[model samples]
Target chain A: MPKSLVSLLIVLLSVLFATAQTKSSSAPSDLPPGSTSLIDPEDLLSELQSQQGEKPLVFNVGPSILYMQAHIPGSEYVGATSDKQGLERLRTRVKTLPRNQPIVVYCGCCPWSHCPNVRPAYNELQRMGFTNLRVLYLADNFGVDWVDKGYPTTKGQ
Target chain B: MRRIVLVIVVIAIAIAVYEAARHSSHAKGHPGAVDSPAPQFSLQDLDGKALSLANYQGKVVLLNFWATWCTPCRGEIPQFIEFQNTYGPQGLQLIGISMDDDAKPVHEFYQQFKMDYPVAIGNANLAESYGGVLGLPVTFLIGRDGRIAAKYVGATDMTALQQKIQSLLQAR
Candidate 1:
């Protein structure tokens, strides 16, 4: 091939390679930090179940009431999305749980970062001096990751 | 009387300008893109019952995206079941599309909750089709024409849902 043609081919391949890299890099950032952890789902499941005896406070917050229809057993409803009133509701709910006790928070309203409710609720709890606060960031929405994980769930009201 | 009329006219113009500006700004934010079509799919329940988007033709379908491990998703299920039971016969269909991987827990969850409506396992392609669902219990209310009427990304209200459904049913 002529030198000019060979150069053109190289440029096109480089552009394609660069585009591929950009797409691949974006995936990791989309996942929450906690999700990257290799902790066994079974362990998480056991912890969730064991907490049943102690009933470590688990709170669900968001604007979607449909979230309440099916959720982790013994978890409490915080609010409808992470709006101002929902934040206040979370504060009151957190006040009832022991400060030292385990508290897990999640909102499948959307993604964890964009969720108006869950992060604020979790952050507010942290601000209120709650030590054990962890957010379960599911890959898709809550249904795909958590329920699919085989953790316990209950339905309705 | 002339002064008052001038003042009122000015106020009206101001309000119109403000609204016009706001509307224009929102249009820019939308990037001049046509509305994207909502994702559609069909999956089977554990009982071998097939639930398809087409089945809900001419009815507003509330599609709930959730998982079993999600507390919010769990909490929402019972209310959804209630919603289904309360409105199922009323042209309102509540479909729980679970994004669960393993079928065992979902099967158990179905039995435990005694859910009357359909619950099915969600896969990657389905999630992708639904505009990359990000959270648990994300809900989309598709209107009778099958366009997404409204989408609630988190925990939604039962009363609000009922009202929306009623209004949509009326519209249809």
Candidate 2:
């Protein structure tokens, strides 16, 4: 092949690879099983209410606005996990806890499939060697799945 | 004494039923009912201009609650732009209330999408007023009379929304 043609082909291939990487990274479903084990809304609520066994540390990784509007009572806000700063905050927050400590992360910003926060946050915790971690499955956003269902929620910052 | 007791029992039952019905409706997170007056609010748009439902009264309004990061909400913008262009002459007004935590991304998204409609940052109070915008892409169709004609949760069907808008525009 001509040198110019070869160069052009390489450039096109690079562009395609970059595009694929971008798309895959943005998709929450693309994460591995470590971040995929999900706790259903009702089940999580039941567990929280049950007060049996070790109480899991719940974290809200959605937008601050949504968190302020309504969030699971006692769930700490760690910012939107999709952002770099938010991920860093999550790392700092969990660094002192034991690896086996039960932790739950959730972002009901959008639909489960399109959520931009939870998977990233879950993966970050998994990377940090957290053994007992689960993602709260909010099929719809927080308002519909948790707030509207009459699940306990506290508003404000 | 027996007649008074019967009346008391009837009143108690009526109150119970009314309370149950009210709680049921509130639990559903549906504050805006069809044919009811749309909640009114005055907010500042990105450009610091005043945007209010009252300002758009006597015109059909398509009020959309969305965020910049929401994929479905992003998908609906172009179609909304098209709707504004196609229906503005007929008194169809599209208003966007972005629920984004910050306005920076919203401003970038607005420019990137070339959104023609006035967009504002919405707070918890505004979201609650519109039956709690718990989810993105919730849309409300307001008739010329300023009453809510329809409400759609989640990503909406644009064709049906357009049809509804057309009908609403024809009313006044």
Candidate 3:
């Protein structure tokens, strides 16, 4: 009933509204610590085509079916980052490798924004001290980014 | 006095709508909300047995959309099996929906993993109904009230998932 009470309520409501917006905002700039800097699919393709520098170890961190369907040429099949066991498997795969060796990870399971497997895998690699880690950005899916672009890809698991 | 009462109601409604919209966007798979009724669906399990969201009524449900091709999806199956076996007695029903195209691989993975829970084939339509499955192994936690409780988008921690299941089971 008091004016003061109503003014306090309005201020509280405004703060709550702002908090909700921040919580739900999934802007690209708000990338998680678990994420890696994105590498353009086209750039990777060109780099591969140039065959100038040392080739990076590329890993397909998507579904096995997608790998079998068509993945970047010479990309090794790493487990998806969807569950702990898969992450563990990937850890085992790179456990003994040289930490400084350049590595690129991509998963065309879905859009770059929503891929469940790429970020965790990227974070794990970073945590393992893989300094040259890169995430191949697939804006839509692999079919659109890599395959459609006529990039070299290998078939079968 | 009347103005204050009206203002309070408006503030409450605004907060409610904001929360709902935020949650809806997060679902990326389906716009399922924590107290809202879980979406319904009817599909054939791996054994061709018909299953509907209604079948798991009165029980806490963990609806998983996975793919055998997804290592993480495959990796998470053991826990689902464990939850089903451990909590099935306590009214926890686990349903796995494989997003894989061919049923052959799914069947092979199911048997190889010795999955004890019911698994069904999930299509894009099924995925769209839930929220667009952005990636493999999207998991949904549904309460006994037949409402969605949570959606885990990526690699899930087994210990945390179990703890939540325990709490939900005790809620009844």
Return the top candidate by lDDT: 2
Model 1 alpha-carbon miss at residue A66, Å: 20
**Candidate 1 chain B, poorest ten consecutive residues by summed lDDT:** B26-35
Q: For each of the candidates, give the backbone clash count.
A: 53, 0, 7
lDDT of each: 0.65, 0.85, 0.76
Retained true contacts (fraction), each candidate:
0.32, 0.60, 0.09
- Residue-wise lDDT of candidate 3 within A77-154, one digit each (tens)? 886677687798889999999998889888878645566778788888989999888888776667556664557876
Report the C-alpha displacement of residue B86, candidate 3, in angstroms.
Answer: 0.9
Write the residue-wise lDDT of candidate 1 on B43-117 in tens digits: 897788997888878887888877665666788888888878877777888788776545787899989999887
Q: What is the TM-score of chain A alone in each candidate?
A: 0.65, 0.78, 0.76
Off by over 4 Å in 3: A1-107, A110-157, B1-24, B27-30
Tens digit per residue, CA lDDT, model 2, B61-157: 9999999889999999999999999999999999999998889999999998999999999998988787777668788899999888988888899
Residue lDDT tens for model 1, A1-157: 5676577578879999987554344333433343422123345567766635554566777433335345767777775534576787777666776787777766655543344455566667778988766665543456555654446777444
Error of 1 at B6 (Å): 29
Query: By descending TM-score, how would the candidates be arranged?
Result: 2, 3, 1
Best by DockQ: 2
